[model samples]
Target chain A: MKITIIGSGNAATVLAKLCVQQGHSIVQIISRNEEKGKNLAQNFNAQYIPLNGTVNKNIEIVLVAITDSVFPKALDGLNFGSIPVFHTGGAVSMNVLRNTTTNYGVLYPLQSLSAEVEEIPTIPFLIEANSENSFKILNEFANTLSNNVTKVLEFKRLRLHAAAAIANNFTNYLYTCAKTYCDNEELDFNLLKPLILETANRIQNNDPEKVQTGPAKRQDVYTLGKHLQLFSEYPKLRTLYTRMTESIMHG
Target chain B: MKITIIGSGNAATVLAKLCVQQGHSIVQIISRNEEKGKNLAQNFNAQYIPLNGTVNKNIEIVLVAITDSVFPKALDGLNFGSIPVFHTGGAVSMNVLRNTTTNYGVLYPLQSLSAEVEEIPTIPFLIEANSENSFKILNEFANTLSNNVTKVLEFKRLRLHAAAAIANNFTNYLYTCAKTYCDNEELDFNLLKPLILETANRIQNNDPEKVQTGPAKRQDVYTLGKHLQLFSEYPKLRTLYTRMTESIMHG
Candidate 1:
């Protein structure tokens, strides 16, 4: 299958490399920045196109991997003829490309990706299309890259996007907050790593509710009050701590 | 080493199994509940003693793995004599046992334990003692069960405990919240498993801040507002959604 990648971000570069490794032909790589476009295109021996130039219609699939804010603007200028175009966005809908082409879909890789790090290929892909034929094409395309692929509708995908925020994004923020607190107090954060790993592994076999343990969960009000007093300096953290504890206790 | 476990909870069971596996002699397994004490004692081929009975003073080490609320009451009744007793608690200081016995210490396993689940041997134990001799003994004892053992002070251990809450307990709560939301909505929570596992694995290799994503990090107010609106039925969840998003955006 001949593929043309749009954008040169982490997702675009990763997808390009994976597609090439899977024996799919990457005909072209497009990016607003010449250096980024050249970098990815050179890796796959594909043509590099600037944003101002027209897209090559010979490519079977066009994957737009640009930032969500720029997705609309990028689609406004894209002319892929009748070729199917898919955007790798969790929040954005498949209908965003409705005016651009008849065959449009979504190819959302449900993992936080980074260009500097090696990609983990086992992450699931959430795919959606405007029509059954387009869904089939996009599904096949994703199936070639990953064994874990789901054809989720827009509403369910939105719910998943929200859940992902709570589970992944918000959880990581909590870790960052903890690290910040430790660093400020000149403490070692490494001691918490074992507990972190164990907590994550527990959910593989048991519900988190059954495994919950902490001062708040135990309703140790004295210790909770002490922790709350310590959080006076970090009002936002204090609020979060209080609210989360209350939720866990009552839920 | 001659050991006497003072409780028959998850921590007690895990520590007893590990000690028995290491070929150490468990002198007795004591519990407030006679049945639980007998069951745990049978596993290690040790004697089972009810709380009303006296503990044998010949034991070198006595580990109290009871709940925080019962620690004071339990310690008041136990006779440590010249035996070194340690409580397996992260937040509680060694001073909690100061009035109960002259020889007291702490041996906290920084992992969430479950009686039904098989224990992982590679857990980190935070050891503390009121005196140098007690510290040495606790260190030597922890060495037999786990390779990752550190002598931590009360303040540092408290910080570590708080950090563990963020990384382990709090993270698990997030997973629970997400699972509940998915279940209530009739969505397949299994689809999020890959995302959850990858999120945990990513922190092993990189700083969480650098790999952060989702609506809050991306500042996608539109999608966030939609989510909050969707969560209107769940007041607690809606509040959590708003608070977490605000923290991430502002912090």
Candidate 2:
């Protein structure tokens, strides 16, 4: 499939890489950011088109990977016609693409992507299409990029996106919190790596609730008091700690 | 080394297995629960002694893997005056073992353990001892069990344990929270696994703050509002969501 990747951001960069890697031709890179657009297009020697410019006629698909706030209006003035279009915002609705073209859907790659990451991780694509034929096309395309692709409904995709935030973003914040605490206490944060890895590994096979072990879970009052006493200066962590503890204990 | 394992619980089972795998001879298994003690002892054909029974004279070390609340008093009547005594409670102080034996320390394995887990993962042991000789002995013994071993001071060990609780225990709770939300929303929890694994893997090479990407970090008010709106019925999740969002945004 010939793709015109719109927007020169992390998602665009990663998806374009995967697309090119799978032997899909990137016909054009379309973006208002001329420098980034041209830089990304240089990799495939593809034409660089401005956002308002006419999308390449030969392109089979236009991937608009932009922020959630800019959706619907992001493709408002531009015309895609009957060409299949896929946007990659997790929170954005597939209906947002309805007005753009007769064949449009979402191809949300469910992972935290970054332009600077040397090696892109495996991406699980959540796909939704306007029709069964479009779904088949998108599903085949996504399969070229990743083995873990699922045809998700609109509402279910929204739920998955929210759950991804909780599982990935919130959990990373917890790691950051722990790292910060270790740094402040002059303890080596590196020591926590094995434990962190093990914790992550345990969840692969068992429910997190089943593997939970801590002072809070067992209601160890003395240890909890000691841990809490160390958090007098870290008011934010203290609050989060107390809330998590109570939730685990009483739940 | 000839060793006596005290208690017949998760930690006891795991450490005993590691000891046996490393070719150490079990002098005895002592616990108030005779059935569990005997069951564990049968693997090595070691004697199962009552809690009040004497520690085997030939045993070089006694591993008292008991609850923090039962510590100090748990071995009140038992005598192991000259032998090296090591306990496995993370929060319990090295000082707690001082009265039972002249040579005492802590061997805090910084990972969650369970009797049911089929394959025990790599463990990092944080050790502390009363004297230089005991430190050397404990370090050498720990090296037999795990490749990653560190001699952490008492205060730092406590801090490490607290940090482990944050990174592992708190993180696991977040996973459980997402899973529950997915279950109630009729979304497949397995779909979130890739995101979760990627989130965990990212922290291995980069700082969690550096790799942090989410609505809260980016200050996307629309998506945050949508996520919070979804959590309205879940008061606990809503509270955690808001707290985490604010923490990421402000700090």
Candidate 3:
């Protein structure tokens, strides 16, 4: 497949690398900035083109891997000449591509991605298309890059995206808060690493609520109160601790 | 070391297994129930003694691996004849053993433990003692079971305990909430496993605050609001989502 990848950011870079490694040709690299565009193009052995520049008509798929804010204006004054165009985003609706081209789709990776990672782990790709033919093409292309691919439509995909936010983003925030508390007390944050890994590993084989063990889950009010008092220095964390404990205890 | 292990729960079971594997003699297994006590005792080829029964006077150390609530009453009226005694708990203070015996200490494993797990991973032990002699013995015993051991004091240990609650228990609760939301939508919870593993793995090498991603950290009010709206069907999760988002953004 001859692919043209747009945007020069983390998701874009990772997707481009996956495509090139999988024996697909990256026909062009498009970005608003010429320097980043040229750099990514050189790294992937593709040609550089500005966002407003002409997209190659010979390409098979044009992938837009830009941020949500930039996604709306992604195809402004651009033409793919009936080539299948796919935007990789979780929140945006598939209808946004209705005006871009007759053949448009979405290829959202269900993972918290980072460009610093050299090898992309096996990420589940959630895909959608406006038509069956486009869906088949996009799904086949996605399978080439990842084994875990699902052809979910827009509404269910959005709900899954929201759940992913809570699971990945909210949990990482708690980790940040925990590390902050450890730092303030002059304790080694390193000590909490094994517990964190074990906690995550437990959920692999059991329901998280059933396997929950701690001051909050066991209703150890004495220890919970002590933790609250400790978090008095940070009002936000104190509030968070109270709310989450109540949720766990009551729900 | 001639060791007598008290209780038959997760901590006690793991500790007994570790001691036996290290070629230490389990002099006795003490519990209120004869069945569980004898079961554990027979597993290690040690004598089973009821909580009120006479303990062997020749034992070198008595380890109380019981719940925090029952820890206060664990050694009441039981004479150890100056044998070094230790309890494994995180939130507990070393002073709890002050009235129990003259030679008392703490041997806490800083990891989420389960009785169902057959093999214990390399867990970091947090040890404290009333005196230097007790500390040396406990440290050596702890080193036999685990490579990572720290002699953390009561105050700092309490802080670490609170941080562990947030990192392990609170995050598992968040995972439970996320899984609940996914189940309601008829989505496969298996899709979350890879992301959960990757999120936990990232913190092993980087500062969690620096590597934190998602709508809450980005302060993307639009996606956050959408998630809040989705959670309106479940009031508890809705409240949790709002509080966590605020904490991540403001803290």
Candidate 4:
């Protein structure tokens, strides 16, 4: 496939690399930033085009990996001439690309990615399309890029996005809270590393509900009170501790 | 060292295995449940004693892995003759064992353990002792069992315990919430596995606060509001989403 990637960011760079490594040609690199655009294009031996420049009609597909705020409009004034277009944002709806081309949908990788990583880990790409033909094209292309590809439509995208936020963002926030507490209490945050790793490992094979273990789950009110008291000085943490404990108890 | 363990639970079983692996002798297995106690003792060719039975005077040390509820009273009138005693619990203070014996402290593994696992992962042992001599003895034994051992005092144990609960229990709850959301929405929870694993892997080398990304951290109000709206029907999850979003926003 002859691909054109618009946006020179982390997701864009990584996806472009994947496409090239999988025997696909990146025909052009389009971006608002000239330096990054040229540098990325230089690596691919592809044409470097400004955001408002003409997109090659010869390209088989277009990958839109820009910011959500400037999306839809960012792909403006450029012509891909009925070539398939795919946006890499998770939150945006597929209909947002309705005006861009005849065949357009979402081609988002469902993992936090960094371009600087020496070896990019396998990312589960969530592909959604407008029609059956477009779905087939996008799904086939996605499978070439990743082994873990799933079709998530617009209806379930936001809900799944929110759940991903809880699983990744909220849990990382909990870790941040715990690390802050350890720092303040003069405890080594390193001590909790093994427990953190085990929690992640255990969930791989077991349901989180079944493997749940703690004071709140066991209704150890004494330990729960003691934990709450320790966080009294930090009211925000105290409330979070209380609310989460209640959530688990009721769960 | 000749050891006598006063429990037949998961922690007790794992700890006994560790002691035996390190060439220590399990002099006896003591528990209120005779069947489990005798069964555990049979594995080591050691005596099985009732919870109220006499402590073997020749045993070098006694390990207490009992529940917090029945503690202190459970040890009432039992005599250990000042041989170093250790309790394996996180939320407990070293002072809790002060009433039971003259030389007693904590010998807790920071990671959650299950006896059924064929190979136990390395657990970071957190040791707290009443005296310098006791600390040395406990730390030495802990070193033989685990490569990761730390000297956490009573002042910091409770705070560390709360942090561990947040790192393990609260994070696992978040995973459960995400999985439940996926199940209700008719989405495959397996798709989020790589994302979950990446979040855990990212935190190993980077600070959680530093690597924090998502709508909450980015102040992407549009996506945050969309997430909250999707979670509105589930009030508890909605509130949790709001609280966590606020936490990341203000963090």
Candidate 5:
């Protein structure tokens, strides 16, 4: 499969590398930044094109891998002929591409991608398309890179993105709060690493609610009070601590 | 070293087994329930004693490995005859055992332990003692089990516990909330597991604040609003979602 990836961000970089590794040909790499675009194109042996430049006519797949808000502008004037164009976004609907191309779809990968990770972990591709034929083609293309591919509609994909935000993004915020408290108290945040990893690992084989442990889960009021008191100096953390504890115990 | 464990709970079981693995003798296992006490005692080749029964006089270390509330009652009216009594609690202070024995310390292992885990993960032991002699003795005994032992004071331990509550407990609750949302939407929660594991693994080497990714972290107001609109039917999750999103974006 010959593909053209639009954008030179994290998502573009990850998808470009993975697609190349899966025996796919990268025909074009487009970005507003010339340096990043040239670098990514060089890595995949593809032609580097500026944002408004024309894409390769022979490319089978065109992937718009920019942020959700910047997505429309990035593909505003690009014409991919009859080729299937897909945007990699969790919350952006497939209709966003209606004006740009008739053969548009969504190829959202439901995993946080990082440049530093040497191996690409199992990425669940949540796909959507403008038509049945486009859907089948996107599914087949997704299967080439990952075994975990599913056709998810826009509304359901939005909900899944919400859940992912809570599970991944918000959880990392809590980690930041934990690290902040540790720094303030002159404690080593590394001490909490084992517990964090174990908690994540346990949920892989068991339900998270059933495996939950802590003062709130066990309803240890004294310890909860102590924890709240410990966060008295940081109002934001204290509020989060109290509300999350209440949610766990009573919600 | 001769040790007497004063409970049959998860912490007590893990500590007793780890101590036995380190070639230390478990002199006695005391609990209100005879079956559990006897079972744990048999596993370590130690005597099973009732809660009110006398412990072995030759025991050098007495580990009061019970819940924080029951800790004081377990040590009340019991004499260790100059043996160092240590309570394995994070928020608990060393002064709790001041009246029970002349030699008292804390052996708080800062990790969540479970019966299902066959091998003990790396557990950080936070140690505190009332005197220099007790501190050295407790340090020596802790060294036998783990190399990640540190002499932590009471206030620091309490704060560490609070941080841990967020990093582990509150994080797990977020997962529960995410799972609940996924179940309600007829989506497979398994799709989020790889992201969860990757987020935790990334933070092991990088600071969490730098690696945060989501709609809120990216300050995508449209996507954030869409996520909040999805949770409107579930009031508790809606509130948590709004507040946590705001906290992440602003706080």
Candidate 6:
């Protein structure tokens, strides 16, 4: 497919590279900044477009892989003609691009994409479209890049995004809390890696409830009190620990 | 090394199997229950002793892989003569076996072991000893089973256990929360596998703080408020969401 990506950020760069590697022609690369636009465009051997520009009419798809806040404004003056327009955002709804063109949808890659990181091939992409024809086009487009593409509605995708926040974002915060605590105590954070890996691997076969273990889960109030007391030096961490433990024990 | 395994629980089973695979002679298998003792003992072709029976003095090392609560009481009656005794526990202090024997130590595998789960070859074992000679013996014993073994002190091991609780136990709870939420909403929990795997893999190279993302970390009050309201049915989950969001925002 002849594709045009409407962003030059991490997600845009990574997706562009992957699409190019998959033998898709990137017709144009769009960005507000000319330099970033040119950089990505040069990599994919596509045309670079600044703000207040239009996508190629011949391109099969126009992927609006930009920030949520700027997406609507960025598409205000742009025209994709008959090409399908899609945004690569989890939280943002597909309707955000409804006004941009008749053929609009969402092409969200459900993974943390960073330019510095190696590309992951099997990320589940949640595709949504305003119409059946557009849905097929987006679905087929996603199929070429990944095997794990699912056509989900906007509401279901939103719920999935919320759950992702809990599992990915909130869990990462717990890791950050652990790392901070370890750093302050002059402990080796690397020692926690095996535990992290094991916990994750356990849930692959067993339910998380069945595999749960700790002071809170075991109801070991003495160790819990000790852990809470130790957290007094870090007030924010103490609050988090207290709240989390209380939720686990009482809830 | 001639080794005798005490208790036939998950840790003991895994350790016994690993030892047997390493061509070590398992002199005997001891458990409070005769059935489990016999079952484990049969695997390694070693003698199975009932709780009322005597210890095998022929064994050079006795590994007391049992629960934390009964560890002290169990050690009180055991008579291993001059044999080196070691307990596999993280939070239990080395002093628990002080009066029982002079040659005592700790050999804590820093992974969540289960009898049903297939054994992993490279588990990080935390070794601690009451004396230099005991430590040397435990070190040599650990090197035979796993390549990654650390001679950690009791105090440091305690801190590492706390870190493990955060990274493993707390993180698993978050996963449970996500799964529960997904099930309640009739969404496929399998969709979360990629996100979970990626989150774990990212920590291999980047710090959790640097890779952290979501509405909470971004301080998007609107999305956080929406999520909290959506979680009103699950009061405990709601509290957790609110508290975690506050921690990430302030931290």
Compared with the true structure, what per-residue lDDT tens digits does model 3 show for residues B1-251? 89998998778888898888888989899998789889999999999999889878788888888877675787687766567889898878777777766888999989887766666766889999999888888888889888999999988888898898889888898899889988898988888888888888888877888878777776778777777777788887787778777777888
TM-score of each: 0.93, 0.95, 0.93, 0.90, 0.92, 0.92
lDDT of 1 by residue, B97-136 (tens): 8775678899988887777566563688999998888888
* Per-residue lDDT over A1-251 for candidate 1, one digit per residue giving the tens place of the 0 to 100 score: 99998899878987877787788999998888899899889988999989888667887898999877666877666777678989998778788898778899999887766675686546689998988988989999899999989888888887887888888888888878877888887777666666666776677777777878777788887666767777788777788788888888788
Evaluate model 5: give its TM-score: 0.92
* Candidate whose TM-score is highest: 2
For model 6, the stretches where C-alpha displacement exceeds 4 angstroms are A33-39, A69-71, B33-39, B42-52
* TM-score preference between candidates 4 and 5, better one: 5
lDDT of each candidate versus the true structure: 0.81, 0.86, 0.85, 0.85, 0.87, 0.82
What are the candidates' individual DockQ scores? 0.64, 0.77, 0.71, 0.68, 0.69, 0.60
Ranking by DockQ: 2, 3, 5, 4, 1, 6
lDDT of 1 at B212: 80
For lDDT, the strongest prediction is: 5
Candidate 3, residues A101-150, lDDT tens digits: the string is 78999999988887766557678999999899999899999999899998
Better of 1 and 5 by TM-score: 1
Q: Candidate 5, DockQ to 2 decimals? A: 0.69
The Cα RMSD of model 3 versus the native structure comes to 2.3
Reference-based TM-score, model 2? 0.95
What range of 10 consecutive residues in model 2 chain A has the weakest lDDT sum? A69-78
Candidate 3 docking category?
Answer: medium
Model 1 alpha-carbon drift over 4 Å, by segment: A33-38, A42-44, B99-101, B119-121
Q: State candidate 1's TM-score.
A: 0.93
